[model samples]
Target: MEPQLLHGVADSVATVVIHHPAKRNAMTAGMWRALPPLLDVLAADPGVRALVLTGEGGTFCAGADISSLQGSPDEAQRLAQRAEEALAAFPKPTLAAVRGHCVGGGAQLAAACDLRFAEEGALFGVTPAKLGLVYPAAATRRLVTLVGPATAKYLLFSGELIDTPRALRTGLVDEVLPEGELGKRVAEFTRVLVSRSQLTQAAAKEFADGRTDRDAHWADQARGSGDPAEGVTAFLQRRGPRFTWTVPGPGSA
Candidate 1:
């Protein structure tokens, strides 16, 4: 069967499953190609306030299917980069529900999300060094931004897969739950996110994303704009903040 990008919506959240269990949910070229548009639809849908990415079976994603890369490294690399771009550039809050092995491209995928939840015993690594492959620029930046340059370099250069606790210590995964509780934990987390204001979440994500960069435009926009004022006012007045500002188009910002 062809690899699938299964999608569904729950409450105000959409879930994207990378379903390729035979190979531990390793991503295929076609599946990678299909991602951005799938994400675009969710982003444009008013009902979707958040999105979750997970893998079929017990495994999250094992990165690219190396066997599929035989004579098409260039094509494979381009497709992978495009997929990473899609996840990284997605406007709404994105979460990666990780389990089992997350290596190479899979790590890249999880790192692209705004939040990452890994199950106990989950393992993470950037294996490009072992494969003698150069990590994609965008993916590399995401890793650096997540755990800082030193830790990122340590993972990338060593090609050593770290356990869930170590990964958590290094900020690789935000939350690590018991293996069996991944789905329930993710559901609870998603529900919490869905209940909150979409505008505040979006602004918070935007501000966090730009925190490492020198430009403070995002900070200025969030503080100087009327959104925070409205949020505070709503809080004091015992109402919800009506946030109307959305980060441009799906892939624009």
Candidate 2:
């Protein structure tokens, strides 16, 4: 079957699935181009609290479809990079629920997500070296930030596949689950994310991604949103905090 990017929302969590099982869900050029617009739609929807990126047929993505690599590769790589940047900058929480092979460009997409959860038997690799290609600078930097310079070098230089345990040990993956449990675990975690204050999560995501200078507006937002007051009152009243702070769409000040 032709490759496709399939998406749906349930319980406020949007799941984006890469579907191309015949090639282990390798991403086609069209799929790469389709991603940014889809993410924009989800990002602008206030009801979509989080996103989960996964692959169909028991595999995550194997990488860019090699058949499309025969000609000029610039446009394909550019589209892939654009999609990766969109996922990285998504205003709300995003998780990559990975299984099976996640290599090359597939690894890039997973690394772009805010969190990664992998099944026990999954494998990961950054294989630009094997293909005699240069990995994108932004993606390399993101990998370095997640696993540090040494591990990043190890993956980029050798182009070797690492299993789930080693991936988790190197901090490449946030969690490793049994084969059958990844979906349940990811769903549960996103539920926790959905119930939290959006203001807090968005600010924390920015800081964790290396924003050192505090925007004066974050402080003003905290006070004006009443989240702090509601949280404190709910704690004292022995009730769950009803947080209603919605993240403003991109470019809203």
Candidate 3:
């Protein structure tokens, strides 16, 4: 099949699949540009309460298509950083369900998500050093935040692959599943994510990402939102809460 990003929404979860298995799912220049707008559409859809990013077939993305970088590595970096920022800023819960290799730009995309789950034996790397390209500054900061300065420097400087065990220990990946179990766990976790309160998740996501000025905004959101009340009622009644607050699409209040 042709290389592309395939996406679908089911049961309030939007799944974005990276397809390019011929080159181990490496993304081309066009795929880099396609990601942000696709994420926007999904983020804007009220039906899409959470998102999962993954690769097709066995392997996750190996990296950028090296051939695409022959023309201009700078342009590739630009598009990639843009895509990464978009994923990081996505208001709802986002998870990277990874298998096989998640290297270079693929690792950047995965790190942008709120959480990452890798299958055992999956390998990961941040590989700008291999191409002699300076990784984007914001991307570097994000990496540092995820894995701390020492671990981040190790990946950024060495450009060597780390096994899933080390990645998990360093907080690069949130969970490492045994082979054949990654998909099941991602589905189960994302179902729980969509069942929760968007008000709480969105606020917590922003705060966790270091946007502290939004406390007042979220406080107002909670006041207007019925989720808090519903949560209490559900606990008192011993039933699951049907949260009513929905995240507005980009640019909407």
Can you give the TM-score per candidate against the true fold?
0.86, 0.97, 0.98
Tens-digit lDDT string for candidate 2 (137-213): 99999999999999999999999999999999999999999979998999899999999999999999999988888
Which pairs of residues collide in model 3?
A: none
> Over all chains combined, what TM-score does candidate 2 have?
0.97
- Please give the lDDT score at residue 85 for candidate 1: 85
Compare the candidates by TM-score and give the number of the best one.
3
* Candidate 3 least-lDDT 10 residues: 66-75
Predicted candidate 1 versus true structure: per-residue lDDT over 100-185, tens digit per residue: 99988889889999999999999898988887788888788889888889989999999999999888888888999986998999
lDDT of 1 at 128: 85
Q: List the residue pairs that clash in candidate 2.
A: none
Q: Which 10-residue window of candidate 1 scores lowest in summed lDDT?
A: 244-253
